[model samples]
Target: MKDRLFEKPLEKQFEFDEEVAAVFDDMIERSVPFYRQNLDLIVTLLLRFLKPGMRVVDLGSSTGLLLIELARRCGVEVEFIGIDNAPAMVELARKKSRALEADVTFLCEDLMRYDFGGADVVVANYTLQFIRPAVRGKTVQKIYDALKEGGLFVCSEKVLMEDKWLNKQIIDIYYDYKKGQGYSETEIMRKREALENVLIPYTIEENRSMMKEAGFSAVDTLFQWGNFATMVARKRGK
Candidate 1:
């Protein structure tokens, strides 16, 4: 389905409900700049890091697209689990994966409370920002705890900049990008209002600091465009 969700007057705040689940792939690709490139980088990086029999956990795994793609490209030896709090998202993800025969499990569970188990890799693409600011640190710690020694925590987020002028300029540029993606000005503003308090962001430095504080030995950014960035944080080896 095409993304006309915001074209009409929004009845409620933005959420990962059935309506969003149906066109999630279309919506995300259009909304996030360089998202496809980010996913490609993630897949490539995982291929280098993944070993047979390894377990990969995805948090906030809306629609399970990334895991499904990875499962197809990386073979069935590596286990893939995608967790989402939204039932609609999980259901659609399961349906799609089953239709494609992709070896990925879709679980409807709150990512904050879900156990990642002893996994080789954990991913949280465009996820952490939705978490409450107070609990983000604890969540990162859980991710750190779930990783085996030398394991990686791969994440992407809509970050902020400290410089007010630069930040405003980036946001303006992002709005322009959305317009280019076919979102009318009214649709953009409506969606923004819907997400006003729901989608929160942090600075790149703050994200790195939080990850390091959560016991990740090293954190490095893999990609960034406007306000969005993908980063990798490594748990220390024994």
Candidate 2:
């Protein structure tokens, strides 16, 4: 199904409910610029670092598409875990994994409180931005603490530009991009209004600073396209 979720009046703030979960795969591919390319980049980078028996966790894993792809391509015995707060998403993810016979565990739990255990790679694709700014740092810290020495944290987010005018221009361009992807003007505006205080984004610098503060030894952008970016941070203690 296409993302007509915002075509009608929203009853409440944007959330990962059944409606959203049902169409999330389609929505993300169309709404996010270079979504597939970003995932491929993440998989390739992770493959370089991951070893047999290493564990990979994907925060806010949605329908488990990334995990499925990773499992299919890694060609090694690696643990794949996906965590999401939405039961609907978790259920759908579980179902898909079963259908594909992919070795993935999907858990429905609050990410902030979940025990991350020791992981070689943790990914939060477009997930951290939804977390409140005040506690985002703490969440990153938890991820850092949960990683093994030299572990990697891959985060992808929609970022705001520091320049106010440039920020507005970029947003307009993004809206136009959505329009080109078949989203109507009214649907775009409605979705924006519903996500007003819900989907808060930070600047790229601020995101890097947060990761550094959380004790990541190094951080760098792996990929970027206007407002969207994927960052990699490494914990450097062996």
Candidate 3:
């Protein structure tokens, strides 16, 4: 899966990819204020897996929302690196960070090939769906290899499931909820198209297994809201 996701050339240049960026930028901005209300529990759980001074990488970081939030709440001397393949998005992120003078750096690079060697904690929030399953395992292994012993990895994603009915039900609920939150039906359709166009997603079980196979000492789903999930794993120390 990882291979497939990465193999699809990021042919769309950054500036011309505003359609992609708009989908996310608006979505995150709309969702940001609600994070404390909706995701505090999960964020807390993921936080238990971290410590001060950790070298952290926000893989597939879109606008650096999670990176910014984590840094704000962590109260630690952590180095934050935000990685993404989209140059336009990365530049936007850098602009935002500069305005706030936040200590986060955005790198325009593919997560599949990015070196994670010294990272202590890696967080890939809502960005795993686009990763091809074929290279997913290798990507996970690369993440593991990038970490020092006992390092942590947290990935939040949109998952795939075997039950078609359940999938639709979940997707329906998602659309309805988003609509209620002010997204137009057309907007909702656009978002769905973006995911489909990008070839997004993995089954929950497949993700857990991928993490374990990549040499994580332990892997577990810490939280889920319909198809959205937070996966936690760790590299074991000798």
Model 3: weakest 10-residue lDDT segment is: 1-10
> For model 2, what is the C-alpha lDDT against the true structure?
0.93
Off by over 4 Å in 2: none
In order of appearance, the predictions have TM-scores of 0.98, 0.98, 0.82
lDDT of 1 by residue, 1-238 (tens): 8998998998999899989998889999999998888899899889888889999999999998899989989954999999999999999999999998999998999877777779999999989988889898999989999999999999999999889999999999999999999999999999999998889999999999999999999999999998999999999998
Q: Summing lDDT over every window of 10 consecutive residues in candidate 1, give the lowest-scoring window.
A: 108-117
| Higher-lDDT candidate of 1 and 2 | 2
Candidate 1 residue 122 Cα shift, in angstroms, is: 0.5
lDDT for each residue of candidate 3 in 158-222, tens digit (9 for 90 to 100): 77666999998988887787767676676556545545646568888888888888889898787
> Which lDDT values do the candidates have, in the order given?
0.93, 0.93, 0.72
Cα deviation of 135, candidate 3, in Å: 1.4
Candidate 3 Cα errors over 4 Å, as ranges: 1-16, 29-52
Q: Where does model 1 exceed 4 Å of error?
A: none
RMSD of each: 0.9, 0.8, 6.2
Clashes of 2: 0
